[model samples]
Target: MNVSQSADTVWNNPVGRLLTLLVGGGLVAGVLTIYPQLLPVVRWVVPVSLVFWGASRLYRYGVADSLSLAAGCLLMLGGFTYASYLLISMGELAGTVAQLVPVVGIFVEMFAAHYRNQG
Candidate 1:
């Protein structure tokens, strides 16, 4: 194959998508680490974004084929609830997990979209 086609093929695959997610997550983490003050913004942004995304999907497609959208909302809610519980009763690990939940949800949604497009 030509160089352009080879590049497109690499980026269109699951592994490349995963790698992109990891790199994006890592960049966000690094930036947050550098500017700890942005934590509050991130906390709000994540949940709000999740809600908006879920709402948009529900509005556009309904639940029939958007299980992942519902799951993403649930993941966000569950993560935040658990994080809050942990913070009140335990510690920082919960906060870390809360941050990670949306990332995992995003990966799930991405794969779902990929497969849906294929099928």
Candidate 2:
């Protein structure tokens, strides 16, 4: 029940990773379709990369494990929400979708993992 074990459980399955990647990418793309500028390439790429890396490390190390993941996710969610807010404040109606993408992706990932385990 360790974090590394959990991650290995999550990652070793091709179906699970594919499911997550497809779902996550689609969600992110869908959100971007609205206010694409909300996720400026340079501005978000590095941060997103870092978050993913950090999440993986947190998962592997089990250093507060789920808490670490949750916190990272929440922090990113908050950032996305805030970015949307800023865009909205500037009179845009398409930014909130950015916040929805990863949120949905998280659920997708969880479901995929659960289903994989069940099988």
Candidate 3:
């Protein structure tokens, strides 16, 4: 292969994939280090984030079924977390509903918009 093609192959290969993962991981580490207070909320948020993250990854990998499952799980977690305060104050139902609002509202709207454009 020519030098240009060789370089292009490496750039698109597994090593390059690892490098991107490492860089993104480092950025997350740095952010957490700078904002330790995020730990608790992050625990809850990560799963929700992963829901979309996993969904997108699955979609990219041609795994729509997996994305659908993960998305459902994510929405459930979001509702629970969102209603945390309500759970503490008003009891279970209200707090849970609150969590659902933010999670469902944001993800669903974005998801709908995404698919709408495809059609």
Candidate 4:
């Protein structure tokens, strides 16, 4: 199968999706543990991932379906930037929460979409 088909298969399959998440989480954890000093550089992974994901969606479905994705990515980038600032100026907890807000928002969006489709 082609790349698109492979990606769809993984995304559509519950086990594959879970495994993908697990692997990604593990990789991130490992990287952080192995090279703590790279933390600053690692933070950029989110926005870069967002950009690539948005670009892929735009490529596959065109601009009509990607405007929101582009906007969301931009908002996320801004949020991340602010979160980094919070980390430097505020306490660790505040900075951590700021960083996690976007992640939680994404999960909430995913669940909303899933339930909306089911109903």
Candidate 5:
């Protein structure tokens, strides 16, 4: 039943959505200021954060929500692969994953929250 959530409320998720907006705003602004060429990609940054956010969401959230997270992860992986192809080598994929330290940490924390709630 999606618990207490409503259709309009999905986008307004408190923790992840809010943080994604704040950080994503800054990221988009910086992209616009520094590299106008990347303006198009600015839309991508927030959604990726949302992906990690949703991944961390309670399983009660919904099966579709979980699917969204998987799709988001796949999108991110594809994006990384494409970028690597253009300007990075396969060897550098390892380094790129390393650069995802903060992301991994956030995801881990979210999972911790998920498990803690379960127990």
Candidate 6:
């Protein structure tokens, strides 16, 4: 209703929900990665998810009028791209961390929004 609320909504994106889903799927794929039979699945999922996640962040923030958000998205994409490299070299743990970190970020964002709303 107010200008502040409208601005807050602008920064919000359904990408958070998609991010959460990817995290969950990544966890499942991670467990599968441990099995010799499932190694093929892991190989495919890791790179694909990395690309998808990066693009999602860019698309979510780049469309907004906020330059800061676009910058943040670019930074996140850089970190995420590096982490994807770690995923392949460092094995399942690295991949799992890469996937889960964004989920933590999403929660942090949610908490910040909640606190700001309270204030």
lDDT leader: 1
Counted clashes in each candidate structure:
0, 0, 5, 0, 0, 0
lDDT of 4 by residue, 1-119 (tens): 99999999999999999999999989989989999999877766665565454445445545453344444454455456554753568677776666666665455445544654675
What's the TM for model 3? 0.36
Q: State the TM-score for model 2.
A: 0.30
Candidate no. 6 TM-score: 0.33
The lDDT, on a scale of 0 to 1, for candidate 5 is: 0.54
lDDT of 3 by residue, 56-96 (tens): 54454343444344455555455455546533675567666
Highest-TM-score candidate: 1
lDDT (C-alpha, whole model) for all candidates: 0.68, 0.59, 0.60, 0.63, 0.54, 0.57
RMSD of each: 6.2, 13.8, 9.8, 6.1, 12.2, 11.0
Q: Candidate 1 lDDT, tens digit per residue, 27-119?
A: 999999999999888866656666566556556655677665665565556456544653566457866666667676677667767766887
Q: 2 or 6, which is superior by lDDT? A: 2
True-vs-predicted CA distance for residue 34, candidate 1, Å: 18
Using Cα atoms with residue i matched to residue i, what is each candidate's TM-score against the true structure? Answer: 0.46, 0.30, 0.36, 0.45, 0.26, 0.33
Off by over 4 Å in 1: 1-43, 75-90
Candidate 5, residue 11: Cα displacement in angstroms equals 10
* Clashing residue pairs found in predicted model 1: none
Q: Which stretches of candidate 2 lie over 4 Å from their true place?
A: 1-10, 41-43, 47-119
Residue 1 of model 3: what lDDT? 100
Model 4 stretches with alpha carbons more than 4 Å out: 44-77, 80-84, 87-119
lDDT of 6 by residue, 1-119 (tens): 99878656654757755666788888877787667687766556544564465466456646453443444344455457545655457667766676666555455445544554675
Residue-level lDDT of model 2, residues 1-119, one tens digit each, is: 99889778877899878887898889888888876786777365644654564466346535444544554555456455645554455334445565554565456446544654675
Global CA lDDT computed for model 1: 0.68
Residue 61 accuracy (lDDT) in model 1: 54
